[model samples]
Target: MKFYKRTETRKINIGGVIIGGGAPVAIQSMTNTNSRDWKATVRQIKQLEETGCEIVRISLPDMGSACNLGKIKKNIKIPLVADVHFDYRIALEAIKQGADKLRINPGNIGSKDKISILAKEAKKAHIPIRIGVNAGSLKKVHNFSDNFLRAKVLSSAAMEHVKILEKHSFQDIVVSLKASNIDITVKAYKIFASKRNYPLHLGITEAGSIFSGTIKSAAGLGIILYDGIGDTIRISLTANPVEEVKTAYSLLQSMELRNSGIEIVSCPTCSRCEVDLIKIVAEVEKKTSAIKNLKRLPKPVKVALMGCIINGPGEAKDADFGIAGGKNTGILFKNGRLIGNVNVDKWVEKIISMIKDYCR
Candidate 1:
């Protein structure tokens, strides 16, 4: 079954990139560096861009950092989003200095008048606004009775913010309702997605360090994207931002929604096995990390390096290329047909060369 159906909707341009209404799912990341430090911010953004991040968000904590948007925009190739909290003036200044998008939680931005001014400035600059609602920052009226209730409250708060922007004739908007709790986050997004046409940014806010965060993000994002609920995704982690980009792509790959770079398919060595499958897979992964521009293989090409022939060849019959173990020799196969045997000593080198040739 097709996991997603294209929805007819309006398009919002963040910098030169357009999202919504049948656009490719965009990947986004936030800068952890000090935004006021122009050199550091620009350097981090360039690194994210290099990793194929389509959009970057930076915190504008004060007027000084808000002023740095011009320099940051000048140096970066992707859209720049200003994450503003409680300060309408910073939102205004961020736009004046050329921010391509503004992320503001109107529920905390003080008053209706302030929300109006922020919306007007964003509308005047023709920049989209993202109404980011987090469970940690939800409105006080929410009782937090149950997971579903909390989601409902958060979703309502987000829609209210969107209406405030809409009041000022602002329609270029996106919405994100985030919660640390996986169930609540999923429910909140499903609730919001059902009622609105705005592009939703999917994430599990404050998902912990690398191992746990990756699991949490993959589970939460995997479920939502499969249901056709996400337009863009950010895998929030306490680890380095680079990990976020990697996790986002992995989630997309799991859904068969997209593919980027080399996808290694290997097997676990058993008692019947020979040859070091673990080391071989690791070495190949490290070597191919630099080739990111290859087009997706015409089909899903599996490269299997299995440990035993008894179950190996049959298990990997669908692979584009494969290797099964012999005593001190490894037999390579293409489309399940044996090609040749190579000694264990030269197996890693042979596999690496084969992958490079395939990529070429």
Candidate 2:
């Protein structure tokens, strides 16, 4: 059932987290809070940590913000990456403040000398640098009509930045080529991966609000990851960063690349459905979202919530645990066998109780 065969790339250490070189694809998210607000930033990061975010990035808009990187890093459990743009001094300050990594946009981070300075400092600090290239910010492309050509330009821009770092004997680097358009993003990553061995951080930049963003990121990241071309991912959404982390986990789990959390297989209610299947599934999700470390279970937990006997029985049999809904009652299946009947009202509680025991 597993469809992923990870692309092999050199490993880079950000804090203690290892990325690429066949490591499990790491999930990352950036904070939207003011970087100077250490308490708020730390609080958001802690929430992300609880939801399984392995790496967190914070934007450094000013010198004051860059100075607070260490304070924020001290309070969080995950790797901290300082996102810098336009100014190399901010990146230098971020390195001095003990940032685990630095993410710089190639288009605006300035001259080769500035890049060398950042490279030397980063190498001395032993921190990796992520060259984040975005299609909308490309300095080389003005008006390109072809997606493939745009992809080439994006890939070339990334390589040019990489060379600046590599020329200074800095090799601990990660790269991201992002475009709001899925096709351009995928093409850009493929071209870059084919030419180098640096670890890639995947994402769809400026992907709209939650509903649209999730679908776009899932489709784009899915294609790239399926081709075994990415090492890490950030589901950029115009929603809470927590949703981004959750979406990243869902995408990875659906591909069989990760085994964590509850995987719900619920049916789209049909005319035959006699129970409120939608409400039941929503209740189950709400209750189980608080379950910590479900990955510690022996295997991924599959919970099915089917509305009728037609596809219910089959899906329930295939899942680790499930409920096939009926008029006022439901059929419970656990470990591929009928456990017994339970009233529809108790389905959510039953599933939660079973998961707790299974996880234990």
Candidate 3:
């Protein structure tokens, strides 16, 4: 069944890319490197761009790092965003130095006048602004019952920033309401989405390491995106940023919203198993890593490598191509029809050649 996205009204441009108005959901990631270190920061941005990150954000903690925005912009292909906190001056400097986007909470950036000045500079630069409100930093007036209070605070804070940007006639904007709690994060986004037309950036803030973070991000992002609520997404993890990109694409794939390169469907080896499915899947993943630019399969292809025929061919009948195990031999199938029998040792090489031929 085709999922219908609830397209938000506002269409904001981040550099040359548009967010909202039914655009393809953009994938975003932030650099963990210190922005003052140009070399490290540039290298990370390049790597993120290579990983299919449509937008990259850098933390601009002070004026010096904010000034480095121009240099960072010169080196990266994707639009660069400045993540600023409390200082409107840094936000202004970042715009002057070519930041394509600014992530700031106007309420925390000193005063309404200062926010206006920064907004004016951002408007003059033709850059979009993202009002990122996190649960950990809610304002004092927000004291609803803790049960639903986080969502209320996040939504209230985001709207307040949105108002400041709108007041200055700065309509190029996006909004993110992130919380470490999955339920709160989901609830906050639903509330904001119900009330605003600005593009929503989806994420579960401070989600733990690779394993835990992927689960949290997937659970929260999955529910929201499935409901047609997100315009852009980031799988925020404490691990390497590359993993974040991979997780984002995986989440998109699960929702049938986007696809990148190969989607391998494999089964866990059980007592009925005969081959090393895990090792083979990993090798296949590495070999096809170069095909990341193909956002969706040209033709739908499901390549399954299963441990045994007990549940193999039937389980993978939808696969365009697949393999099921025997003792030391395996059966290869294409579109659920048996193709040939091959030794288990040659499975990886044979699968790679078959994929190459299919792509051709």
Instruction: Specify the highest-lDDT model's number.
Output: 2
Error of 3 at 235 (Å): 0.8
**lDDT (10s digit) by residue, model 3, range 76-176:** 89988999998888988888898889998644667778878888888888988898888777764246557467687788888887888798888888999
Name the lDDT value of residue 29 in candidate 1: 94
Worst 10 residues of 1 by lDDT: 292-301
Where is model 3 poorest over a 10-residue stretch in terms of lDDT?
292-301
Q: Using lDDT, rank the candidates from best to worst.
A: 2, 3, 1
TM-score of 2: 0.98
What number of clashing residue pairs does each candidate have, in the order they appear? Answer: 0, 0, 0
User: Over 4 Å off in model 3, which ranges?
Assistant: 139-145
CA shift of 115, model 2, Å = 0.5
TM-score of each: 0.93, 0.98, 0.95
Instruction: Indicate whether candidate 2 or candidate 3 has the larger lDDT.
Output: 2
Candidate 2: tens digits of C-alpha lDDT, residues 1-360: 666577789998989999999898999999999989999999999999999999999999999999999899889899999999999999999999999999999889999899999999999999999999998888565578889999999999999989999999999999999999999999999999999999999999999899999999999999999999888899999999999999998999988877776889999998999999999999998888888768666568899999987779786677888899889898998877888998998999999999898788
Q: Give the Cα lDDT of each candidate.
A: 0.82, 0.91, 0.85
